[model samples]
Target: MSSTQQPQPVLNCDDLLELIPAYAFGLASPKEQQQVESGLTTCPEATAQLADYRRMQDDLRESVPQIEPPPALEDRLMAAIAAEPPARRRMPQVHRAWWAAAAAVVALVFSNVYWISRSSSAPPKAPDTNSHPILVQGDSSFVLTSSREIRWVRLPSAQKNTDATAVLMWNVESEIGLLYVRGFPPLSAGKTFQLWLTMGDAKLSAGTFQVDETGSGALLFNVTAPIDEYTWARITEEPEQGSSEPGEAVVVVGEL
Candidate 1:
């Protein structure tokens, strides 16, 4: 059997010129993309226009000079950043139900961990069958406020800063924590100090902070979870932009 096939029409340059910009910017539909591509092969004017558009985009991007933010805007941004809390730690590859169940079990074991003894609106105490949670041990300045279930742990110097010492005070219920560090030398240029919480199999960033010339600094960090559920803490030196994981520079280490 013999059948005659009709030839497809050639798209002219005038029509292809209008669609060229859309194809270059990825805004062309499938049909338009096919038409413009076929037209570019035969129309030298359309091809040159496409190349010119590409060059123009590149030139526009490269021509802009770097501009630093104004001092007042930078200050406001920094102030806003300081007011916001650090992100919560994540247990990668763990199921969400497992996290809830674990939290429940910890709450059952340490029932009195959230007892704000002095608060008038505090809830009636649950039968605290287990041993009492960590309380205010001594008259230390590390704990700025009087809160229940406060864990005060001494962090001694680690591998990096031998003279540095730190103390951590955290409230289990309120999710408020404080860190007091002393005797740390100023970090080198582009280096920053960060606090990390070791919770279960995950390590979470508490926040980054800076110390004075004498190596004394204090940071107030907040966590959405109960701080007492974690067992360990570490102060490490990280890049100025921050890190997803801890580095080898362990300045102060403690068990909470």
Candidate 2:
């Protein structure tokens, strides 16, 4: 395995990922949020992966135009729910028919909840922006002493991807940033992912990450200069130790 292999652990990482959809949607409870934040330290790449999921979800939602249901959608759905009464006694064995009916019941329940929540006309409030990210490396950690500025920039184009997605979240004051990317083809052995922060004639290595089997990767790294000082950023596949100057092809790029 490469030294850059995904960091050892992020607690119950599978469980944490399952919670990401809720976490990103702001539907997670305070306790769940805390659980993610506390364990998110073990693998900052996982946190970046979570961000990728959030962006994908938002893009999916945006692409699917909203279609209002028929006026009777609510009333008809309610009647169908009432018609199917619950089975009072536990069965020794469940059958296929029973499973089908149970699925319908679950659907009805979620439909009701969705409609109720969407009843409000007000747009959702934004997450509080006056906060900083805590970056942890092993036992030591630091809350970014950053100015109250965070930038969420989507990498608009990729040299190697026809359907890849990447997003960069950078804190200018802290000189630290996290990047998450999905859909790039896995590289040949001996290659690794590296980030580049560029100012006119100067370039600095911001961070590096190892891609998993799924060809998704992320990194949290120290930026050498303020975001405004850099005109762009990039992710490149280089030798395992990475390069001071980009050696391999750049896979993803974005404006700072």
How far residue 67's Cα lies from its native spot in candidate 1, in Å, is 75
True-structure lDDT of candidate 2: 0.59
Q: Rate the local accuracy (lDDT) of all candidates.
A: 0.66, 0.59
Question: Across residues 104-199, which tens digit of lDDT does each residue of candidate 1 receive?
Answer: 332333333332223324334332333232222122111223222344677888743158988776544456676667788789999989999998
Score residue 66 of candidate 2 by CA lDDT. Answer: 85
TM-scores of all candidate predictions against the true structure? 0.43, 0.44
What does candidate 2's lDDT look like per residue over 50-106, in tens digits?
A: 889878987988998789999899999899989986432222233324322322332
Over 4 Å off in model 2, which ranges? 1-133, 138-148
Regions more than 4 Å wrong, model 1: 1-148
